[model samples]
Target chain A: MPVSIIRPIDIWFAEQIFPHEQRFHAAALRISGSRDEAEELVQEAFARLFELEGWAAIEDPRAYVVRMLRHIAIERLRRRRIVDFRQFADTDHLTLADDAPDQHRIAAGRERLRRASDLIAKLPERCRTVFVRRRIQGESSQEIARDLGISQSTYEKRLARAVELLSRSWQGDEDALPAAAGPANTSRRSGSR
Target chain B: MSIFNEKQRRKRRIAREAATWLARHDSGTIDEERFHAWRGATPEHAIAFARALAVWREAQSKADADTYHLLQSRFTRRRAAAAIGGMGMAGLLTAGAFTSRAYAWDSSHSGVGECKRLILPDGSRAMLNTDSEMQWRFSDDERSLWIVRGEVGLELVRGIPARIHGLDRMASLSHGRFNVRLEGAAMDVTVLSGKASAAPVSAPVVMPGQPALIPIVIASPSEGLLLSAVAPSVRKASPQHLAATIAWQQGEIVFDNEPLQTAVREYNRYLAGKIVIADPDLTGIPVGGRFTSTDPADFLSALELGLGVRATPSNGGYVLTR
Candidate 1:
């Protein structure tokens, strides 16, 4: 809890562990089922790690931090006792829980979500279908291929195409234009004053 | 394929392979040793694998209810089959064309203190006032525009049969210039040139100055159409009111003996920090000016000097009291 006391060693430790931060957060999200909880759990774990004596001597720090965060998440989950496994099973994935603070991060996340949605909207119809089936509907590759009357390899290719387009969009490539440049900027640029 | 296309295809193939490996890894089906070996095979492989993993994780985590609805609406099973049965490449080309055209005609928005002018595909022009958003749809047979929020001035072609939809009513124009303003559920249509027939989407046109409930509909493909019923009264726009209504387009706020409350609201639309009237009695004080829309400080000075009101800074904005 003494995390407010900043020190050079803490800064060094945070920098050392920065690369693994996302992976640790992803693992924590898997266990916590909430992005805010996962972020808090990871920050708590980092603070705890910094408080430990001889922190410099720890090997495989990424694994150590991940393990600590997972333990914290599991303990919190047990304490809450409100974990309904049925909610996880439901594919609706409603993000009703408010995650306040870090407005910049929330804005960036929303922008990413908007961009991804726009890219998905522009996908070739067949490719989009395969992607939705595999990712959103949680359908298996073999089942989708059989249902679509396409070879398994072809289905996989379509899925890959969808992924490729999404990746390009996230990377802000020309093929998948950014949402800000979508209708407004394009028209402004092409139309005469 | 050209060399550039060939190179892109090769990169996509690698990315796809990496994506497949990451998917398997996430599902607990991949051989860890082989996966590690494949990732370490080359620096490019590791980079692709990392990017693919990030994309997959983000896709999984961010697919909330809104995204689910969008995907479901667009990628239904029957439509998927039809798209595949038709020429796949042609379907993709047409989809791309539609998307670009929609972009060109979809929406125009202006930030605070900023005015935007847009030239429609048919050579007509529209100027949007500050803090406004409008959606437009243009086709070979008809030209339709919806002022979803804020104010817009249109200079239509001679005979385009254009229709402008506002909050509580829709105006049909055959060849004229006009402006539409929507505040909350109230719509005010000003005819600058020629003429337009106004009617509620769900009801017949009512006499001017009579209160009537009118339903407004905004057409959207994914969500169908959004309909809102609002009680609004229409007015035959006079020259005096029309100029004041669109003064912001000329970078000024022309308040002609309006209430302080109305002038403050109009000023807030074009400025960043808002002006708050702390006393209820101050709302009825008459205000008239031709100040620049971007300068609220000048307005405050005028209020303090001419109206015998005191202006004090409060909560990141100025509060006025008499």
Candidate 2:
């Protein structure tokens, strides 16, 4: 519960490293040819970034992440004693990719924000109440718990449930929830009537 | 499968813990040292916490009052089912007074040289270009947008195709991305990835020696349709052309072998201080390059360097001459 003062590293990672996640995942997929391996490669690159001391001095974070992913993939292949040099041959252009936010990326960001709303709506009724009040409406926990005639712990639990489901859903987890909410998984997007 | 399930469970546990920490931080009841220790425990922990923070920050800023009201209105069980049914029945359930009014009709206007992005109630996204005005109305069975002026880029969600009304004509836009501009009674629609069929708002009165208004369907990303009562034409747009069309979204104007007058006029859309060609002869000269839309300094410099032209400050604008 780091309150009041945020770590400088967290800010750098969230701003510089996190925004380019889709690209990193895509690149990792191209190298690994498996979703699970791609996820692991991206996570390992992020972990290495956390341990880096010169992280702040990097001018282009997207390219830095791409290079890191390539290194991590190479390391994994070495450990497994099977390396596909061809897979990594044409990837030099990726490190030189433009870091500017393009029109498609801008649209994707808007879609992400909208998807957040849709995910919140799909939450269970109890969890949705706490989430809408605390997260979206910016109501204090105490105020929401009191207004809803619930105990403080109950409010926290409901909120935590909402957050867990939403986090999984946002990360594209198909089994994030059960049929109690509806189908276990909907498409990437479910239109609101 | 069991191993995968185990991994999933561990991931879920980390996510839940991170969320709890974030909540505690928000409520001002966190132990800072313990929070740092937990985050430093593993790479997955740090990643989980970062994801939670991203969601928290986005909801804190992007989910504005309108979205909040919409969420509250659809808070009930039956209404939630209706929303999921995707049958456009949620609006008919008397969702809420503020909810219906807020979602049924909304309008926004962007100032000159300023662009704005909006998330409509039906989850559709619209970006208003400089000096643009638009309004949206969503009912139980229909979704429509009215571009009163200027340009708008639309990304319609998958459900009901949206009806676009501009000037005296209209277009039916299905799920896709489109750039639509209203220029003096004409609607220019460039479909980036969608389907659009343009027609007049009313039945055309066929008269002697007058061509009847024909409907045009633009189905490919390489097509742009100009919809007007007088003359409606479909033009093939290359990939480069499409990129140039939406370059304004990135605060850029691209000129590919375009006349100097045409480029100047396009750039003028995003500038407060207009650029005037004092020499009429230079107007027809072809110019090609990309320049920032909001500034004319680089553009003028390019003109000066490319051709034997000079710019002089005149009446809060720039006058160019050979």
C-alpha lDDT of all candidate models, in order: 0.59, 0.70
Off by over 4 Å in 2: A1-5, A96-105, A177-193, B64-322
lDDT of 2 by residue, B195-220 (tens): 88765444464476977666445545
| Clash count list over all predictions | 0, 0
**Interface RMSD, every prediction, one decimal place:** 18.2, 10.8
Error of 2 at B150 (Å): 34
Instruction: Report the lDDT tens digits of candidate 1 across residue range A40-134.
Output: 67667766765688664454466677667656765665677687665343312222122222213323344555655666777788988987777
Which number leads on TM-score? 2
True contacts kept of 1: 0.15
Docking class of 1: incorrect
Off by over 4 Å in 1: A1-193, B1-105, B203-234
Model 2, docking class:
incorrect
